[model samples]
Target: MRPPCDPSKFVAEIVKNVPPSGIRRFFDLVSGLEDVISLGVGEPDFITPWHIREMCIHSLEKGQTSYTSNYGLPELRDELSRTYYRRYGLDYDPASEILVTTGVSEAIDIALRAVVNPGDEVIVVQPAYVAYVPAVVLAGGKPVIVSTHRDDEFRLTAEVLKPAITSKTRAIVLNFPNNPTGAIMTREDLEDIADLVAEHDLLVISDEVYECLTYEGKHIPFSSLEGMKERTVMLNGFSKAYAMTGMRLGFAMAAPEIIRSMMMIHQYSMLCAPITAQIGALEALRNGNDEMERMVREYDRRRHFIVRGFNRIGLDCFTPKGAFYAFPYVGATGLSSSEFSERLLNEKRVVAIPGDVFGEAGEGFLRCAYAASMDDLKKAIDRMDEFVGGL
Candidate 1:
């Protein structure tokens, strides 16, 4: 008889060493509970717009179920080409310059893999989305973490970013409006870093999935900066804006060569995004703006409400001008982020992600997502106040 196989040994040591996502453990806790107000998952509360869903259904009804080109549906890419030019004044060739992936997450992963050789250092700003660092490591790149501060509204200014770049630096990841903190980098702010990126001849993986939800001045594409377009891979998706998280459709726009490389990895790995999801995404790009804007207005309203609620209860929360999260400093409570989050879940039935999961800098903070019903937001705040009072 053949010896019992040890499939577990096939897992690389580095893969085994990578910690599980900090955001998911709380989600796991929330899943088993009843009457819990969760402020953890960074997803919109709105359902996918009716038209978008209708398009997906219509496509399936028409028997359009086969896999699309690895580069994604040409129609979607053509729409994307027109849309990017119209929205950002940046033109992308639909045939050679765009690649649709399973989601923005996959785009990020593939972009890193395509450009990052083993041991190359990729600058990752923190507190960042949970996936960024691990993605860098798995891509065989060393993650050089750059921490942004609350005083700067968590914007990664050139001053903080300069020190992180080294001779081995290969690329950098940019996300704004940022996750957890809801940070927005102004045009001048991006220009500051753009200069450094151009100076160093580095690459940028700009994750603009949250771009449409920006409530501040217009969102500027980092690729629009002079001399930066060729070095930038812009990742965006329908998940956040159209509330199509389940669809998992996202695209990357980049120089022809960069896009081709990413497409190679995507073709072999994911093959193509789901046909139905791409259909829904096509509808979103075509006509989902009205519903998207309506949802943004609601999120903006909740944004102000939740920030005010946290501030009123003595948690110092910076007003986030974009995205749907409020990062509140819970250090005054003398509880570590994990301690505070766990106790809040156990005693108060309120769920919040601990800042420590975002990175070490995220310690002593709680990321409370406002993408929930106002009723739930209010109740969660009350419970938080009670929890802190008892502490």
Candidate 2:
């Protein structure tokens, strides 16, 4: 009999060390259960605007099924360039500085792979998006985590970031309007960070995927900061703003050389983003502004309702200034984040992600996405109150 192949020997050590996404584990668990109210996923509850969907269908009918340029359709890039300039007062050469990818997720992966050298350190702020550390690891780099606190509204300041830098530090990952914790950095905050990055001569991967979703103040583009454009790779997409998550369209804006390097990786791995999706993205940029505004307004309404509801229920939720999630302190329930989440799911039939899944600092909190319907949100809150009362 042939000996069983040792899978451990064949699998790359780096790949093996990386854990599966914690967000998806709970998502999959709750997906199988009936009538469960889920606030676990950070996705928009709205569908893609009908015009955008129709544009995709129209493109398909017109035989626009062929692959786009490896860097993506030039027309789409032009629109992105114009939009960025108009929205954030930043200019990018559509031809050289922009490259479209499957999603902001892919933009992140390729950007890290393009810039990181083996053993180089990438400073990642926590609680960060789950993909950041693993993407750095896959690129043969070390992720130096700097935990941000709710006391400071989870903002990564120059003081917190400076201590994490070392001789080997090559880059910093900044995600404002951040996931899990919807914290945003003010202009002054970014100015401090920008000065630090300039002094250290470090590259920056700025994930502004939630830029358009900011509530309390305007979203600032990191690359737009003085002396930072050349050093920053800005990632954004249509997923959250246009409610086109499943369409998987995202873009990166950086210096020509950095974009060139990312394109080399993207071309080999992805070839091109789906042409139909590109067409839809193009339409979204052109005509989806009013719809985007409408969605944001609705989300704002829900945001206020949910934050108030959580605090009233004794969960002690800090007001989330951006993104669709509320990271409420669940420590009062005398349960660890996982225990609280699991028990809540099992007994209340309402799902919220355990915050520690985002980082160790997230242990006493739970991430509750407010993207569900008002009716569902109300129902979940009521059930959660009952659960907390029992505890």
Candidate 3:
């Protein structure tokens, strides 16, 4: 008989070093509880628009279940190209510059792999999505974190970003309308960073999945900046904007060279994004604009209400200009972010994620997503108010 294999010894050091997702733990804890009002997960509460769903269903009925080309359906790529041109004045070749992946998650993974070499340093703005640093590490790269402050509306400016650069730095992962903070970079703000990128000759992976959900000014695509198109790999999808998170459809746009590099990794691993999801996404681009607009308007209303409510209850929350989260400082309650989140879950049956999970800079805040319904948001606020009063 063969000896039993030792799993721990066989695991890669990089995989072992990465911590489990902080968001997932809270989600699992809340799953078994009763009457828990959760504002922890960043997913939209809205279902995928009915018309998009119907299109997907129709495609399935027509037996369009075969795998698409490794790059993706040409029709979907063409739609994406047109959409980018219409929205951002950025033109990409549908045949060579676009590659669809399972989701933005996969796109990030492939983009990192394509650009990062061993010992390469990737600058990650803190209070970022949980995946960025891990993806960099998995690609055999080092992550250099630059913390953004609430005083700056959590925007990453060139001054703050400059000090972190080194000879080893190869790329920067930019996520505007950022997760956990809902911070959006203005055109002027991005110009500063673009100057640095030009000076350093660094690649940029721009995650714009939340592009459509900005409540303030229009979102400026980083690739739209002068000279940035050649260096940027733009990643976006149907998840947040269309409430199609489960559909797992996302695409990357870059110069042909970068897209081809990313495609090699994707073809070996994922082969292609789901055809049904691709069909749905195509419909979303073609006809779901009004429904997408309606969802954004509703999210804006909830954003205002939640920010106002948090301030009224003595939790100092900065009003976010984009995305669906409110990052409120929880220090006034005399508890660390984790402590507050724990007590809120155990004592009040409300769920909110600790800010520090994103990075050390997130310590004093808790990320409260406003993607839930108005009723749930109100209930969560009331419970939180009572909890704060007792504290």
- Candidate 2's error at 69, in angstroms? 0.9
Model 3 pairs whose backbones collide: none
Model 2 per-residue lDDT tens digits across residues 43-114: 999999999999999998999999889999999999999999998889999999999999999999999999
Q: What's the lDDT for residue 339 in model 2?
A: 94
Candidate order by TM-score, highest to lowest? Answer: 3, 2, 1
lDDT tens per residue, model 3, 42-98? 799999999999998999899999999999999999999999999888999999999
* Candidate 3 TM-score, true structure as reference: 0.98
Candidate 1 per-residue C-alpha lDDT over 306-341 given as tens digits, one digit per residue, 9 for 90 to 100: 989889999999998888889999998898999999
Prediction RMSDs, each to the true structure: 1.2, 1.2, 1.0
Model 1 TM-score, all chains together: 0.97
Clashes of 1: 1
- Error (Å) of candidate 2 at residue 38 is 0.5
Of 1 and 2, the candidate ranking higher by lDDT: 2
Candidate achieving the largest lDDT: 3
Query: lDDT rank, highest first?
Result: 3, 2, 1
